[model samples]
Target chain A: MKNPFKFKKEIVNADLFNNDLPLPHSEEYPDEEVIFSVKDFQFYYDNGEKHALKDINLEIFKKKVTAFIGPSGCGKSTLLRCFNRMNDLIDGNKKEGEILYKGTPIDTLNTIQLRSKVGMVFQQPNPFPMSIYNNITYGPKCQGLRNKKSLDKIVYDSLNDVGLYEEVKDQISHSGTSLSGGQQQRLCIARCIAMSPDIILMDEPTSALDPIATLKIEELIRKLKEKYTIIIVTHNMQQAARISDYTAFFML
Target chain B: MEKKNKKINLSYLIERNIKNRKYKDGITNGSTFLFSLLCVVILFLVIGYVLFTGANYLTPGFITSNYSQSSVALRTPKDFVYNENDYDFSDLERFDDTYYSEKWGIGLQYGKDNNQNQVIYLVQMSENSPFHELVRRDDGTNFNIPSDMYLSYITVQTELGTYKTAFSEDGIENMISTLDEAVSIYDSNFLTLGGGISTSLITTCYLILFTLIFSLPLGIGGAIYLGYYAKDNRITRIIRSLVDMSSGIPSIIFGLVGATIFIPFVGSMTGTTGGNIFTGALTMTLILLPTIVKTVEESIKTIPKSMISASLALGASNTETIFKIVLPNSIDGILNAAILGIGRTIGESAALVFALGTFITAAPSFTSGNTTLAVHIWYILAGEYPAYEQACAISIIIFCVVVVLSLSTKLINYLFRRKRER
Candidate 1:
């Protein structure tokens, strides 16, 4: 008799629709092709007892790698999560100001559509408890991609893109969490990529990995920037300098 | 509020303190060991007493035979043949104390009857035996010897002479030899009495299956709602506290509920006027839901919050995330719940007595009221002539199932951990 969904204010519909269209005024923005524009964006937590981010202004260009580097508790990851509205899940967390995705406010777009295009990877590699193939296909399958051939292609291509194919190609049906910490992060990125998103956000993805794996992910990021716009938050200054084309410093 | 100054003790002299410390340690250590030893001893005492008493009565006939007795005064088979080496009793496990006639293919053992009075048991009857071919004397209807039977009286009429003996006045060897030499056996066995628990064992199995069938889904659903989706509020808190409290209530209260609610409800479909196994199963479901939910909730809670976020971040809906991520992760706990439910269902009694009557017979259907192992124990012990040994025998059977269930739980969890590790 006690229902949990009854307490929820938002009913999320993540179904695919045929009405999605391309961004408006794309040509009017000129040659730079600014992917996301944050103007006076401020964030607070715990009913404003904590001000996480304030008056932040930044522009992320298309097919470019931008990094947010700062000391701890500076809301770098907070701002990154705000891009996909991941912070919307928490209770009593308030946000003021606006973020524009390709000259259109992100709030106007459907949450499913917005998140489909703006994918994210967490600080710790948290793969869903499932086989590698199922883990990679979960998002696409949810949106009704049922063609077995295409699903297999998506799985192979995404794993290959992150350079994890060579290591885990034989055990695609194995559990995703069984992989090493480094391989798990790469699998998380591959899972995000399997959705074919336009942007990929990584929050300290390599923090838990060894240096060799970090180098591989940095190399993957450099190669990935040619096709997808990336926004990463990291405390490693050299990592920001090595991988990111544009860097912004964040503070509490 | 006023604060009192507390004195903290420090060892003024380390060497002097060592003696005091050793003295206190000895007392504490001895008491801890003593209490733990007491716990182990109590466990073994209960198990050993039950096993020692019950093991004596736990025969194949006691486990696999019927609960009631059926008697036939006269029976004759339409096609009767007595051939040499017609059947062999050599392969059968011999009760050394039994009188086995290899020529007639019958083994008769001295076992206690239903009332614990010493009687001759018809332990074995191989194919083509005269007993299997015999017919009722009064009505001339064929009466097949049940695999499990007791020898009340046997009469043999041979070409040489007529030999007869009652169970009480048996030179069993002479009677059986006379049986082997018979040209025709006459009204051989009369009044096969009941002592076995085949009905109760089967009833326990059915109740366990039906109880799990009804309770697992509800328990898992409640656990998922509380673990993944529920808001921490007064209503949920109340529901949680109720679940905890329900597990503590006596099983008899649940039996009363089943009697009041489920008996009539099931009776409508089953056409049973009294308490039935289905009603008992419903009661068992009510009793087991709390354990199932609690274990599942504990496992579901152990799943990292990041996995849920990761799924949602990948554009999967909350529903999709739960089915794929949360449910799969908590499978070990669900299995554990099922095994625990089975163990509880086997050992349950008081509630089942109210929901299912302690009438052990041929389980005509789930609609027919019958006793489970635990309820059978209660029925036997509750009588004026308490059959403690029989009750203990039933206890041994219940304990076996529970032990096997618990061991399988451990095996399943181990396999799960190994799979996850791989």
Candidate 2:
């Protein structure tokens, strides 16, 4: 007779407490204000159904990196989507609490205007099937900027800021998808930035990437938080601990 | 005792092997292979049969000329006296005297005299060819004239002094000569820009244009409503079911409906009674709309919800997201639907039969009567004389055109997909 199950080896936790900071670090700028406030928010897929998120209250400050760390299906991504009303696309999806961006109700605001102000990067890199130049210029063009010079400048500035400029600047006609996975992910971030949105939400942005690319994106997030309000969802605890100023832990 | 234990162990091992193997092994049955082979065989048979029939009728002259009845019928004098008894020198002088000219000297004549004393002449114009001109001699003898018998005398000279013969006795030969005549006549009479082909071409193009005009936007709009705006309720389910079922209904029924609905409405509104391009287009649109809607709806459904989410998160309205992002991304799918709709419209026969009648006339205006390729094929098939081989040739032409269209559509789709991926 053979044993029903075999032992699958588990590697011990390496790099433990590597990026964790000592508790109670002082704020870099104490004068800055909180831009987003969520109060006792609960998300439900149906009436009296399984609660995806339960009585969660949180704040996202301007020019700060706030991260959510959780296991699979723990509703961390769901809470992130609340800031931009991304949950509205799901049928029968309801929320029980309030989300405020700059003291105004998120639900009552025009969805289009709110989305323009709050941009998001998905876990999977989804660059439009167009030229690298077009990918960066998509949002700006959608906002009705038609001048070639203006578009060129926006493409240049956005790519430069994302550190992908030298690799792609000369190959303007190349496809956006032709880039390396790390570059495509960075291009998505650049696309979010090119919109000039005040808030940027990232949903496990580097989960699909290799280690070196993941490190680059983690570092880039810290630099991005200097100007834009940032909230990132990550399954990797060390990533949340590395760049996030405030970490929210969640469990399913 | 040892032998008994070994036998039990062997039985147990056999049962274990049977249990471990699942039912879905990868072997294919004979029936499936036979059925697949049958389909291929049937397709080849149809193609071979059509080609065989069509080749029997097609000749170079048949393809290029117009029809003339005078080419085949026997010529007889309106008034001539008949001799009752003689076979040889009886009508030979009369035959030569009446038909032979200085250029057409000594035309060959042969055939037996009938009891009525009428001479049936079989005219042998060329020595080795089946092309012979038949002339009726008064004594019932038939004469064969050389193919050049008539053309030899029909000479015209230019200033350069070169004689040009305008008429020939052996009208283009092989298989079905009358159809060859019809093909030539159709081309010469209709296909020229100011003639038949141009008029029919413009009518078809206009019909296609109006069909797109009436069906595309409405179909796409309906698709968007069903795919995006309509809640997944009983009403939507019923609407979807109805559209799906309508596609299964025969096209002829739609033709009948169109004939009853559009012909009278347009006829009353415009104060005219008869066929027109506009009426045909309306009929085609009704036939095409359901197909377009179903195709476009399937395409819209393939768009990921996250794309819409991303757009909405940026504060784009449903309409804005749909128009700006969804539609642009799904352009290939929309184009596929449109091409298929056009192909369906072009090939549809039964619907056009009732909506646009069988008369092959040059349409001068939207209100004028016209016939399309499929309608012409139908008329050729069902005509009083029943031109079978000609109909087969025309069908082959239509089949070739459709094959080319479908192939180009596939090629365009491939290119668009490659460009989109890039």
**Which candidate ranks first by lDDT, i.e. highest?**
1
Candidate 2's fnat? 0.49
Which DockQ values do the candidates obtain, in the order shown? 0.62, 0.33
Q: Candidate 2 A-chain TM? A: 0.86
Task: Return the interface RMSD of model 2.
Answer: 2.2
The docking category that best describes candidate 1 is: medium
Supply candidate 1's per-residue lDDT for A192: 98
Looking at model 2, residue B48 earns an lDDT score of: 82
**What tens-digit string does per-residue lDDT give for candidate 1 at B1-422?**
89888765565577678999999999999999999999999999999999999897887768876777777665345355566656655655667787877767777877666555666767677664556667787777777666445567776666665655444346576667766677666666655556678888888888888899899999999999888877666777999999999999999899999999999898888788888878988899999999999999998998889988998898888888888888888899999999999989888889999898888876535767899888889888898999899889888988888888889999999998897667
User: In model 2, what is the error at residue A163, expressed in angstroms?
Assistant: 0.9
Candidate 2 local lDDT, B185-253, one digit each (tens): 100010111111233445556777888888899888988988887767677899999998988889899
- Prediction-by-prediction clash tally: 7, 39
What are the chain B TM-scores of all models? 0.81, 0.63
Query: Which residue runs does candidate 1 get wrong by more than 4 Å?
Result: A1-30, A103-105, B1-11, B75-135, B142-147, B154-165, B173-189
On the 0 to 100 scale, the lDDT of residue A83 in model 1 is 95
